[model samples]
Target: MGTTTNIIRVLFISILIDFLEFTIILPLLPKILTYYGRDTGINQDSLYVQTMSFVQFIQNLTGAPNDAKWNSVLFGGIIGSLFSFLQFFSSTLCGAASDRYGRKPMLLLSMIGISVSYGIWCVSFNLTIFMLARVIGGLSKANVAIILAIVSDSTTENERNRAMAWIGAAFSLGFIFGPLLGAFCSQWGIAYWPNSTMMFFIVPAVISLVLSLINIVFIIQCCPETLPIAKRDSKQTTITDISNKILPWHLFKFTAIHNVKSVDDIIILRRLGLASFLYMIIFAGLEFTITFLVYNRFNWNSMKQGKMFFIMGLCMALVQGGYVRRIPPGKEIIAAISSNIISHTNQDL
Candidate 1:
């Protein structure tokens, strides 16, 4: 529970690795779309067809003439939305599973799943396979929530903000290095392996796979289970139970059922939840669209885009690590900021 323990450091490192793996693909997405769009011949069975159909629908909706230039942007946005949407669906289930099982087991499982997803991505040959890889990655990722839970389990109310600030800094560090690494590998792939199909994506995917494997090993060796035996859930929750719990009607059922300490407290919580929801929507839109904006406007390749993201990451790290330390924000303000950070940081690339 102490900040000095190996657990916090390991968790921090693990979360950093996770973010690196997640964001490494951001710069490579345009290449992915190009690959699929070029190669998707007469195969109606491909996911590319469905994606194009959806793209066409959007094009029609806006009364805009069809343009090949916008294909990557539209495709990337849809793919990114799919990934985040799946995360939204599965997060509650994963969080509950972590509670019922142990955090260590759940974290290890999630990381391993992510590793496999990256491995699959490295070898993916088609649009369908690549999108499937994204699906697997999205469904497997609930580590951020669990990692934060681990932070909360260990820190006191007064110390929690500072502890979380470090985690936020780690998140920023990941964003800083992840895209840079992607750019390096991408350039390497283009320079040395020009003949290979999907080299642009393969290079970054391989890097992500390697980092994920290392993270998995670190978690197994260093991350001790934080939930005590007495506090662990005894109920053997099956898939059905989890499915039922995550049903739409059940989302706010707990709040409805629980006894409130005060009407004002309930009102405050509802406001926080609403604020968090709106913040996530806006931040996620920005995060997903940034790659498209840079690629189209500045004609930036993966490496140049990575440099831009590196600057953003540097700014984030400076604010979180330096500014927050000098003047710690209040809990409510931190909570709102945390919501924004979680949405932006935890988004799947």
Candidate 2:
């Protein structure tokens, strides 16, 4: 039990650091896009310029707004979508690999990948390199899911919920603090090194890299192999099996589950999957674009953006910690419906 408790604590810290690195860039996305867009030193034939031209061409073709602010938003959106797309595929691969290998090895690999990504970001001089950093970060972001798996492996069924709640709290705290820290670092960098664009971004990247390196060391020294050899899935997962998992199927017709024979069960599963999928789409869309929206609409800088996210994260943590957990078990569907209705109504307003 003491070992289990220690493992959970380490995993919690790992997740908190990962999310801090993840959300640190949220308030800076718009600024990042704008910086690359307006920088005149970039060669016209370079990847950054070519990519921006392609994005602008697509915007023109699609009749997207043709202004600097809108262009920044569009570029940020494209980058954000690419990151998410890569994550979607990499997450499935990582999960399968963990099942085959031990959890610690896969987790270490993920952390190393993330650390390398941040290292690249620290030296990213142009948009192309920055995009590459994002790609690597996305591909390495299986830590959260793997952390949950570790929690499951280390905890008894009766203790799982409490452990999961602690993980959730780590996420909430990360969201609450990460952006503010990033904002402070960014502002400090800009103030101290006013003439250096690289310093503005490098400061936050360096901090993230340090945290990742600490996580990697901690895992190597302390984390144990949760999946014992006797309990391991020895069946070699083939390419086709991995492909099936990675491919995105229609939400209304989920084809992943092989054992459910009842039509009613299938229908219920599909409905639930569709609901979750749509909810994520909407939530993620807003979350990504909110930075750009505020930047464009209110002319807010990083500090203001950080404060906005702080408030948002605080509210989310409060609701989840205070209200959501207390809802009666059978009333989950009703609660979900009510929350969705309220969320959508707020959006409309």
Candidate 3:
């Protein structure tokens, strides 16, 4: 029991750090895009320039407002989408690999990749390099899923729900603090070295890098292998298997779940999966673009954006911790429907 408690604690901290590093760039995206877009010395024929040109062309073709603010929003959306796209595949691959190997090894490998990504960001002077950093970060973002797996491996069925709720709390806390920390670092850099453009971004990247490195060290020294050898899945996951897992058709059909024996259960799972997919689509679109919208409309600097995220995170934490977990099991659907209706109605108003 003591070991299980310690393992859960480590998993919680690991996830918190992962989200903290991930969200640090949220409030800074608009400014980051602006900085990269205005670099006059970058070669016009380079990949970065070409990509930016294509984005600008799309914006112009779509008849979007011709201004730096809106353009930054569009560019930020593209970057955000690109990250999600890579993560979509990499997460499946990581989960499969973890099943074959142990969870600890795969978790370490993902953390290493994430740490290297932040290291690259620290030196990213151009949009191309910055995009590369995002690519690496997205591909390495297997921490959350793996941490949940670890919790499942370590906890009993009765304790699992509570443990997962704590994981949700970690996420909320990360979002609450990470953006504020990033904004503070940016402000500090600007105050001390107002002329240094590199320092403005590098400060946040450096902090993220340091946190990831610390996480890596903590895992190496403290985290134990949660999956026992007898329970391990020894099958080699092939390219075809991976392709099947990630492909939209197979995913929508719930083909990866081999244990469900009943047709009705499979149908229910598919419907639930589809609902989640649609919800995430709407949620992600708003999430990625909200910073840009606020910046454009209110001229919000990093600190103001950070405060907004803090409030959003705080509200989410309060709701999840205080109300969401206490709902009776069968009433989840009703609660979800009610929340969505209220959310959309509020948005309309």
Candidate 4:
């Protein structure tokens, strides 16, 4: 196959899997809560807290605190903490593993892990089970890491921008389609309560599992390993003193080191990092908030949610496809961001 073909194929596969993961699960969450014994957000915007309290009441009465979804917030902090801890723990380690084990195994593991997580999600009556599933899922796979590693190993510096752009396109396409599919499956129990909509998670998990297996057995098998053994072993090269050696990934740290040649570089890097972090946090919260609103405030079914997301996706695609795409890379983008800040500042006035 041509390099271009391979690139497209890889990006398509990665984006497809990611879309399934994100969209399929999200739409059905409304239904998952259906069987939990309530319309939770009924007649009140403050029901978020009320739902948690009610879940707690059930917890004390049933003595199985985890069974109540809303109550997960009350004491699920420990589990949440553990989940975050594991995500941080696994991210770098998984990337390192790909460098050593070759990308295929690590990527395959991630898919399988997530599938199992969703499967557990389908029946997650207790918070502990959900937490465990997430933890295990987080640690299991690093497909993005592996795919990027493959691209790095295969493509030159110049070709990388286009390579990654295509990957991004695939991701966008996934976002465009995954929600609709999830929403479609969600209709299986739209008339029922949110909690009993277990099929939403289950069906997608089954689909993703099949897709992953197809990739693993067919597409992946056709793809050759990019990192040769000699290069891979470089990360684990032996000193006869095994006790003295540190792991490859464990060696990199972001601690303060006084080895900087330019304070300006430090400041610039800090600003960039801070901006990125803020953007990520804001975007995540906004997304979750929107999903919650659509699910609760409207009592919308999966297809509606899917259609809503589809229209949103179409707008986004147009924005990126046309002049707005320029806003990210050049003077235009900087100007646009600047204008936004000014508008926000004026709004505060």
Candidate 5:
């Protein structure tokens, strides 16, 4: 098949697989905790109830005295903002790493990080542990960026878009399935207290670990280095460029990376940055709204909340992946983030 076909294929598989892995937890946690088992435990169930209750209790006073809805929204925004900021930072370093160390190593390392993140979920004792897991996972969170870099290195310019699309599909699938799959696995036992919640993370983490190992042995080993022209060797960039070879990712960091290459470049980058910020803001809002909605409106136990999220995610994935054939990329798409180039021109330009 052609590059388009390949891109679609890879993105389809990657997103689906990842969705399966990630969505499993969204719809199961609440139910699994309370009433799923034949012989529910007095001790364990009580402990779990206390643990989740305490976590939410602590979360409430975490900031201003806003209503629970506002507080939850703020919390979700904080996490998204932090992760977005982190992406800017890690991208620079890891992209640089791809140049020095190679692509496969970074991919393997990132996968390992993901597995460990899920592993922590499996063993979570309380809210602190749960929050910490998200933090850790966020730090190592450059899967898409790193994969894009790998594809850029491996394929020609004409082929890069397709490669990227395939990767996008992988991401979509993961989002769709992660909660659902976690719910399915979490469904295994209802008698235990935290185990109900913990198992969801446990099974996925184990699977993630196995997947990482396979990636390390097979995929990473198989792909060849893409940065054929060494950073130091580029005649166009010059010796000054060699000494100043900063990794070129701008999404994750406040640290400037080789100040916008040109006026046009600056404009382009600024627009993208602002748009990304806004997108995250909205996404954070939606995520928090759903989380609290299930908690208060429905009085859903953890398992029920998980199930709700799973269904929501599945619908989103099917629509985006199955129907929305391809997402356009490049300056036009980037410009889409900034609805009005006129307003941001001063800042971007």
Candidate 6:
């Protein structure tokens, strides 16, 4: 029992770190890009330059004040999208690899990959190196799914939802603290090391790197293999398996076809997946847009943006921690679906 408790504790910290790494960039991205843009010798034809020009044109048409700062937000969005694209492919492969080998190996590898990327960020001097870090870091995005699987393995069905709630709470807390820490580190670096370029972004990245390394060491010392040999998936690696790992669409087919026990289950799962996909499409656009909107309207810096995110994280934490557990699973699903439908309808109006 103590072992199980330790595993869950470590996994929770791992999840928190995963989210912290991702959200830390939210407040720092514009500043990072603005620093990148000051290079007068950058090629005009480069993708980054072209993207900035295009965004500037859009700003002109919208009657918004033309500031080089908009370039940073747009460039950041493109890099973030690139990360998401890489994550789409890597998630399937990592999940499958875990099933074949064991959870501990995959978790350790994923954490190491994340740490290495952050280390790269700490030393990166150009856009190419920074984007490379984003790509490598995003490719290890399967840790959250693995953490969920681990929770499933460790808990009884009755306790699974409660464990998941705590994980979600940790996620909110991570976001709450991540932006604050990033803002603080950036300001601290600027105050003490004004000559160092990218210190604002690099310091936060270094902090993330240190936490990841600590988490990796903790897992190596303590986390045991939860999936026994008898329960482990076959280790066979066929051509189809390889293809499934590379193609994101194949993940949908793999999960739906292999896991669905009934026609009703298939319908329900597909509907939920469709809803989630549509919601994300809209959410991504809104999330990206709001950053630019707030920046243009309020002339806010990274610290102010971090405060905004803190409010969002605080609300999410309160709702998940205080309210989610009181509801039954069946009712929760119904409420979620109903709320989404109403949200869509209101947007249309």
Off by over 4 Å in 2: 1-5, 41-45, 156-158, 250-268
lDDT of 5 by residue, 163-254 (tens): 55456556655665565555555554434445444454556556655554454455444444445545422334344433333433433332
The C-alpha RMSD in Å for every predicted model, in order, reads: 4.3, 2.5, 2.0, 7.9, 8.1, 3.6
Error of 3 at 253 (Å): 1.1
* Stretches of candidate 1 exceeding 4 Å from the true structure: 1-5, 43-45, 62-65, 235-263, 325-349
Candidate 5 has a TM-score of 0.64
Q: lDDT (CA) for every model shown?
A: 0.79, 0.81, 0.85, 0.57, 0.53, 0.75
Which candidate has the highest lDDT of all? 3
User: For residues 146-172, what per-residue lDDT tens digits would candidate 2 score against the true structure?
Assistant: 788899899996677667767877787
The order of the candidates by lDDT, greatest first, is: 3, 2, 1, 6, 4, 5
- Candidate 1 Cα deviation (angstroms), residue 169: 0.8
Weakest lDDT window of 10 consecutive positions for candidate 1: 248-257
> Which wins on TM-score, candidate 1 or candidate 4?
1
TM-score of candidate 4 relative to the true fold: 0.68
lDDT of 1 at 119: 91
Model 2, poorest ten-residue lDDT window? 36-45
Clash pairs, model 1 backbone: none
Weakest 10 consecutive residues, lDDT, candidate 4? 241-250
Q: Which ten residues in a row have the lowest lDDT in candidate 5?
A: 30-39
Residues 1-349 of candidate 1: C-alpha lDDT, one tens digit per residue: 4544556688778889888988898777777777777754575346788889999999889875677767667778888899988887667777777777888888888788889899999988888888889899889888888898888777777767777878888899998988888988989988889898777788889999999999998888888888887887787867666655566444433342245787787677666667666767776876777887778767889999889889988988887776664554555577446646764675554
lDDT of 3 by residue, 197-291 (tens): 87778999999999999999999998999887888887777777877789999999977788777999999999999999999999888879999
Higher-lDDT candidate among 1 and 3?
3
